[model samples]
Target chain A: MSTAKQPDPARRNERSRQAILDAARELVTEVGYAKVTIEAIAARAGVGKQTIYRWWRSRGAVIFDSFLALSEGAEGLALPDTGDIEADLKTVMRATVAEFADPGFEAPIRALNSEIINDPELAAQYREKLAGPVDEAKKARLRSAQRAGQLAADADLDLALELLYAPLYQRWLHRSGPLTPEYADALVELTLRAFRP
Target chain B: MSTAKQPDPARRNERSRQAILDAARELVTEVGYAKVTIEAIAARAGVGKQTIYRWWRSRGAVIFDSFLALSEGAEGLALPDTGDIEADLKTVMRATVAEFADPGFEAPIRALNSEIINDPELAAQYREKLAGPVDEAKKARLRSAQRAGQLAADADLDLALELLYAPLYQRWLHRSGPLTPEYADALVELTLRAFRP
Candidate 1:
């Protein structure tokens, strides 16, 4: 048999990187962020500790990267422009509720979220990587709605955005209630009325 | 010396309980929740582990009791009936923002909140001991506003209450933004507008 072409070094490196991220995600979910260690990730990924260290500085960094990778592939919090502002917002909010309730995403997300609350550096990283982009996108959508005369011109978009997502997040973090589609719909309705011209 | 009033057993027990709670609070603040063990708390309080275990089942329970005790002495979230619903809400919200920003309260609260998010039993306990009473008080105030014609009769008080507090809690949990008095004021304005008749 013809000798198999030696796998490209670049491809091998990428494969190892992806494997390490996947292992981190799995371990964070299975054993939790508190219990997950770099050694455990290296062992689970079947890579040398040096290899992981070369790529990521710490367990938090690895998990954060993995979280970004996972979210990038999922249906993100993009507000669709369906011309009907209320309907578009409802769609986005319902999608958010679904995302929060997703079992595959919940545990690791909660662990990371809790860590972010307690660690200032990680909070900054999270705001830059995730919250900032999402906030800007929603604000842009709200400005468009305001221009269309669907919402009050002077409505505070920043507070408006908080109104849209904060309730769902509170329910999730506090375990105070269910993050159901109906709950999402209610938030959208109340927020729309608040912003109505 | 008058024998120190015979050192009544009841008084001694109360003193020990207070000391244990004080030690738990200080340890949680100093070393953090993860590092604050029962043994460490016992050593710090100059009490035996059995004394702690006799009153509370876990370190979380001790911390929870300490949290309740600390909050009991602080200015609570009482809604004043100043005839103007907006001002009353603003006062309450501003108090919330101040409480959140208190440096002495921040670390232990964050640690306990994160733990509550992760643990189901602790979450339920938190809801009952803290969240439930607060929610009911706010809801009662909203109902009074409805009766006074300051707010819409059909306004969903439950959702309105969420609008009032969810943003504050979200900022605290996500550490995505500053929990400022201005932020609290903005929430009050938006929520009142949403509920206005």
Candidate 2:
């Protein structure tokens, strides 16, 4: 039958999506966020401009999707629940430090950050699509800690998460200080003290 | 005297510098960091491009100086030393919250952040010129607290400052949460707990 010669539309669509995201991440890192265009992304992905437009409204949307895919590819970012909040936090934080320090992630992440900083719409999308899920996971871990009496029963988890993570983020953003394993350990220890039961 | 018809060289230089900085800030707020041109700044300030070049190598440098001038104009950002660390911290942090929330600061500051995030040289300049002095003042306040036995005797002051401020910065940058006085007070309380003697 003629159907035997036809490609599966769903499979083709999935591959095209993956290809577009990959092209976006590569181009953003290579050329910086401001210079990367929809046409360029389409060319790099071996797709039509219309295809890219059909999927994403702008270059920022494509870049955001790339970051979302990158996170999902990195094991869904499930925080380790070892029942020891301090240990789990240190482990996860150290991994984060390592990722931020990696050359592969450095440029693309900075590009993502600059785009997010400049564009309020993209920033809002980032919060909803990317940060929301990751933060929810971290809060789930904190709730587990609270249940185990490691943290204050009524501690504001949002503030607790901010205190735990924002210093590392600031240091990286400003290049204010080094991101080391010891730094990761110290943040966890201090945050625990702050939220002690 | 012939000199009577001419402006003082030092005063002329100072006025030109102020004009350039003012123009840079206004243009960056109006057009954003990426689109602001040396030509536009020169035109707006009624100076030549060579003049901007004579002082700064690029637009980012000009913008950094603008922020530097802004901070200097804001009373050199001296942290209050009221001897009660918590009360003083609350006052300063609330002021910071207000500043970040100000519509006037919102655009230019966001422009500054994105520029700093993308340019390493500009970021280094920002550290040495802008953040350095303000941090020293905060550290001085923290040292006073340490002397009063309020914080740990050997507390890492740099880290302590980061703990107190970075969360607020992250919240503002990410639009992840509100910048409220109560939030500022909570940061002070938690940071103090973290470094309790």
Candidate 3:
């Protein structure tokens, strides 16, 4: 017979946490960040408000965590290095474009983004949790490209990364234009030319 | 005095409208967009709520108009053509950086931007009133540059415009970094290089 621990309290706690986060994300998509309440998240998750308060400080914090949860496993946000800088950046950006096109993902992310912009503390947490990792990954990829001599030795990786991603982000946030794979490809080509030795 | 025509009700109405818009901008900066109300704007401007309702349809519309009023005299958003695309873009971008750094401009603009992103109708209106003009101006400048042989003859002006301003907009909305003049200058140079013939 296989021996098993008695229900695994830690696993149960993690499941509860996941449930709460799932509920928060759903409520945020349905009702928006401003209308999302901890009480509502708790009720939706079949947990008590104390359970939520035990983990998060405010509704904003919960929403931020929920956003991170949603972004997890999103392949587009990941920086891939497949020995070709152009192809790698295009792959990642196309994934990002696809993510932005999904209403299920876009609504909650945009709502949380608004909250982050409004609240400095939450913004800091978001940058640390979400943006910081993506930025570091992209920078690492760019540094690798430099090492491979694909980019100018003196290229500003930070600025180059912004050029790669900022146009898509601007269009996404402002609804200036469609976020298409074609647009992503154009940005990749332009960025490569700009950074080429 | 010789041509005074019963105090010119049109001019009086224009003054009241300006007062209301000014009051809306000030209140948005002070109390934030969420807390700003028609009543508050009226009281601050010494006008009645009916006067505001007579012109604007909602608080969002009022805030939108208030933002336009605030931007009326700003030199940054204007696309200047000095026969040199690099110099002109750099000048405008540096001015934009300065404008964003001003708290009075930042708070109200940020507030209005959040509202625009949240409401599609408002976002459309914002695009028409604000983004439309700036985009047209930039495109005009880029087309002129194309004629002058500064840009590729077949360069995608729309995409090129995004490359010019999107980085600044991304940094502004995300608070990803300091909105410095140096950052603006770097973007200008990168874009010029990317679009070169």
lDDT tens string, model 1, A1-197? Answer: 35357667888899999999999999988987779999999999999999998987777788888887876723355578977898998888898899889988887888788668777888888888777887888888899899999999998887888898888888888888878889999898889888889
lDDT measured at residue B146 in model 1 versus the true structure, 0 to 100:
88
Per residue, candidate 1 scores C-alpha lDDT tens digits across B5-123 of 68788888999999998999998888877788999989989999999999998888898788877766233555688777888888888988998888788878887887788888989
TM-score of chain A of each: 0.88, 0.89, 0.86
lDDT of 3 at A94: 92
User: How high is the CA lDDT of each candidate model?
Assistant: 0.84, 0.89, 0.85
**Candidate 3: which stretches are off by over 4 Å?**
A1-16, A73-78, B1-13, B73-78
Better of 1 and 2 by TM-score: 2
Cα lDDT tens digits for candidate 3, B1-197 = 76585678889899999999999999888887779988999999899999999998988888889888766643355467789999998898898899888987888989988888788888887888777877777888899999999999999988887888888887777787899888888888889889999
TM-score of 2: 0.92
Kindly list the per-residue Cα lDDT of model 2 for residues B130-178, writing each as its tens digit: 7887788889889999999999999999999999999999999988898
* Candidate order, TM-score descending: 2, 1, 3
After TM-score superposition, the amount by which residue B17's alpha carbon in candidate 3 deviates from its true location, in angstroms, is: 2.9
Q: Residue B125's C-alpha lDDT in candidate 1?
A: 81
True contacts kept of each: 0.83, 0.91, 0.58
Computed on C-alphas against the true complex, the DockQ of each candidate is 0.72, 0.87, 0.64
Q: Lowest summed lDDT over 10 consecutive residues: which window, candidate 3 chain B? A: B70-79
Q: Model 2's CAPRI class?
A: high
Compute the lDDT of residue B82 as modeled in candidate 1. Answer: 78
